[model samples]
Target chain A: MIMDDYKFLFKVVLVGNAGVGKTCLVRRFTQGLFPPGQGATIGVDFMIKTVDVGSEKVKLQIWDTAGQERFRSITQSYYRSAHALILVYDISCQPTFDCLPDWLREIEEYASSKVLRVLVGNKIDREDREIPTVVGEEFAERHNMYFLETSAKESDNVERLFMQIAEDLMKQARSRDLPRYDSNTTTIDGKTSTISDFSCCSK
Target chain B: MHFEIMDYELPTNFDVVVVGTGIIESIISAAASRIGKTVLHVDSNNFYGGLSSSFNLESFLKLNIEKRKSICMEHSSLNDTETFFPINNSDFTLDEVTHQWNITNKNKNYSDEENSAQEDIIAKEICAKKWLKDDLLKESRKFNIDLTPKVQYARGDFIELLISSNIARYSEYRSITRVLTWFNNTLEVVPCSRSDIFANNKISIIEKRILMKFFTSLDDNEDLIIKDYASKTYKCFLTDKKLSKNLIHYILYAISNSTDSTLCLEGIGNTKKFLKSLGRFGKTPFLYSMFGSGDLPQEFCRLSAVFGSVFALDQPIHGLILEENSFKSILIGKQKIKAKNFVLGLNLTPDFFLNKVKKKFISRGVFITNKSIMDSDNEPLTLLLYPAENDKNPCTVLELPWLSSCCPKDTYLVHISCNQINNPEDDLKHCVKNLFTLNEDFKAFKPLIFYSSYFSIPTNSDENVNLHDFNNLFICPGPDSELDFVTAVSKAKELFLKMYPDDEFLPRAPDPEEIKWDGDEEPSDIAQ
Candidate 1:
């Protein structure tokens, strides 16, 4: 039962252009292995993993969305409810790197204002590195995002990226857990609305 | 990743090309894709659930403001509008789209001798109802207002469709918490179930007895209740029952939901439908999606995408080519994608095809307030049916509190809709005044009018046209303003059958666990 005591559950969505190795990155973090030439994600797939941050355990519900242009509508709708967004780009593919602004535009439109954003450059193991680490860091800085570069094939910084997200979310979960006057009868969530006042809504 | 789409080898061939992402078209896309049909579902708008999607506060206001392509920066630069925003059937022209806002300034110097009104945002409008613009925009993420207002009967065709297709698994369902009717010049909760009737103190025992007897009679001897009244109005049949005024009001306006001139048999049929639907899911017969009715279409879209349907947003079909007897290709931008069959929603349809059909419209109004008309332990999702008043059509008012996920925290979004008469505001004004405090009054229990707007959308469902003009293209009508989605689902099923004469329609999709995967040598994230 020690495993079931995770205090907070956060939904983390991974989105970027295709061929950026999003599935490889997720597999490397969740299962400690990466499949070479991972196929395109069909719709979306999700997995939950618990990590201990300080004294409390946090569960990360990671959603990997299909990066193909045609599936944008399906993936974009999943953006609003996400707590963190990991925008990935490929270091070897200039086109995928060039599409960072497009990915940023989608995030700005669909995700919430307070969502934590991280910029990731995947496939750093490739010999032809079209985008430099300095450029990736600068792009992250310009957009006020946290930046990290990883290679799913080498398992370079893959676990570190997911751990950083969990730690950041744990910090968020703790701050919001602070007990104030508790005058907040109103909620932004649908859960509180359901169980609160049966008299008002129910016959 | 399905990454690296080659423009040279783009998907040019499909079995069906659905041109709109609305409820009807999305369902057809899912149905077609499920039965081994290659479907290319596209919308000119950049969002899913075209005309049926939930909207944030800022975009919702911009859509109603008309011709103002962009929100002026002087007001607020919160919404970055660089991406082109195209308003569709949900967008309406505004002759008098006006608003007044008052936000009390908290950081002002206080002097006991000086008397002054609190610092406000704006104070020019004469309307008694006003909203704080800053208050609404602050929590915009909590709101999910739908362009079309609707509910689903527990055993309704749409519910059946959702259940059978397994699209219901994609969404959370909430019972329509309550039903109210405007009776005796006041809003009252209509008791549909047996327990509700007995527990309500407003209804006398004798009245309840008579109501029960009538409902029982309808079930026990429907042949007698509906007999000899085929020619006359339902109101006449009720008058002949010698029931008290209270009992008559409950049966006619609340139970049957009939007009004064509704034929007796039709009224009886409607009442029977209502009774059978009650107690099926919850106490109420109706069910509403957790977010808005907009979620229903997206659920189908999710199902379609999982089944390998290619969806593209902001890709409008300019026109289609007809060769001999069938549609050959759809002209999107400068590219022509060939398809054997086509499905289209009846919005912004091309003039070449427009000359062959007629259209109608439904007036709609959306408002956000701080409280419900009737208070209870928690906020409720309610459907209130206001009887037709003189010189106005009857209106349906749906209220979704924060729990309904249709409004921001501490707010309820009320949607009023009716058949378009003269204009939107004119047709729905009386019902709005009956349940809401249009004028500020300290003693009134009616919810304060924090925000309100009215518009009409064109629907060509009433049009009678020969399909021979474009046999391969099936046009799904824009949603008519109504309480439930019975007609919408049935129409989708009928249209689906016309094109897919022999194929099954929307069979249940298997859950992920149910699908047998080959031996897992490598754990791909999609399979993880």
Candidate 2:
């Protein structure tokens, strides 16, 4: 069996108020294009982007909210197993930024305690921005989360946001700070072995 | 900051409105949304799964307290042409709930020499820590205690549907490492695979050869042999084959996973299913979803959301309006949402719709134990089927280790379920006593229960319920007393077909890499 060539795989989930450019940030970072009038995301589950962290390649599986955030119905399973959570808000929208505490409450409730949280204030290119950069920075500082400002329309800071997350997670993996990936192993008689060696009806 | 209330009104129209987030309703929602039908999936409970949700220890206890409060049914006036049926959101399915912590809050003290010995053992092996009740309560969120726990056969209908529909990507699973059986007052591992049969030391060589021959014979059509035993019981067929009593016990209780009175054809079918699913993932034929079985339904809901289905949890439906025997719309608070079709869970269905349908109860017990029932060097995900003894029915036991993400480290989540003869504790007390130690000092080797909960879930066993009054309304049954979810998947398919006979059921959803974003001139390729 051929395995994907990556030293580490991290699941980074995106959550915030709806229409806050969460999808746009993901599309800009993974697809390298800003989809204007990106209607409710359909047929898209998650995006995978492999990047080089130092000498090793790290794969980032980026999952979108799929419009579930609109109704606050995101399943708790969505937060399970996530290595990082990127909480996005629209800079020009006050409600989206004001709802950050609600989003943080959800994160504190559902996400793993060790999960890395990053606060991204999106739509920096909009002229009538309600939230200043300092305000966002102070909020992120209060929450002890990594802070950044990104304009998905102009494709500014989007790449840097994801790269920084990948580098940090890659460093954690190298240092054994994160949980070891044990999805493919089955233990028998105290011995851990990969399941690829076994097949049904081999007899 | 200004306290502003965001607009909470949902769209008033939909192609399909599903009333529950159970496995069947979620599957139907995904199927309908997969084919471009606008869907609105709602659950009165804040959690995703209605009766199938998994809860942490804190919420599980809180839910029991809340379920005890009784609410009178509210009457609503209806027009002359319309009849109103109020929706019952109370957890009527779960009854006789009880949980207790056996261990105290204080940690066990050790002498200096004993402390050094404990440290050596911890350093040498990943053994379970002597957890006090305070530690368990503090880390209660790590536990994913399921209300209706289930396992999946590697080649079963649910697995096939998951792979076929591409919903498998959203979830993770751990293969059940061992299948055990309690026989002759002893717990033993059931040899399920070819390697296991050859490696067995308990059975004689002749018994092993006979078991192997019996299994090999199932591969052949054997139409004549099947016909000869079609009218007889499986035990009678095994006796006629001249197998030893030990082999018969293993075949009937462990492999076939049936009672003594199981028909020959049904028993053979079950055995073949077991044989067919072996080695697909591991030695055992079963795979349990990581976290809990409640995560399974949420995975389908995620697929549905990806396909443009609107979901709103904690949204209660006030009542359902039926106009001249046909389903019309539902009342949510002060809002009326209309849909062309409606699918409701059995608990949400009115009494008139479920008249004459006999309800069967499945007694369930969830226990957090200090060790595995059958100790091994490594923590193993175990499935044990204790055969019926005397008046007790056959019980299914699933012991999930922490690696399966069902419980915290150093503890195992043990679930025992059987047909309800009385209350949950009474129905499963015999099996629980045989497997675990309720008191700390009784059985030295047996696992000690720290926390345990017992409850009974109501399910409709009779299939012939008269549902012909409303063409667009469908009622999905709750989880049955089955080891696997083959029945739930089939029920979902049946309901989907009844609603949309021409629409295709959930087809293969495109992977994230396959979805081409607009404005990209080049084909989007994944960076794997």
For model 2, what is the alpha-carbon lDDT of residue B442? 27
Summarize candidate 1's per-residue lDDT along B138-233 as a digit string, tens digits: 777667777787787766678778777766655566777788998889888888888888988888898888877777676454566556776888
Q: What is the two-chain DockQ of model 1?
A: 0.17
Off by over 4 Å in 2: A1-5, A36-40, A185-203, B1-7, B68-80, B108-128, B356-358, B462-464, B519-528
Q: Give the Å shift of residue A162 in candidate 2.
A: 0.9
Candidate 2: pairs in clash: none
lDDT of 2: 0.82
The superposed Cα distance between candidate 2 and the true structure at residue B19, in angstroms, equals 0.7
At residue B397, candidate 2 shows an lDDT of 95
User: Each candidate's lDDT (Cα)?
Assistant: 0.70, 0.82
State the lDDT at B101 in candidate 1.
34
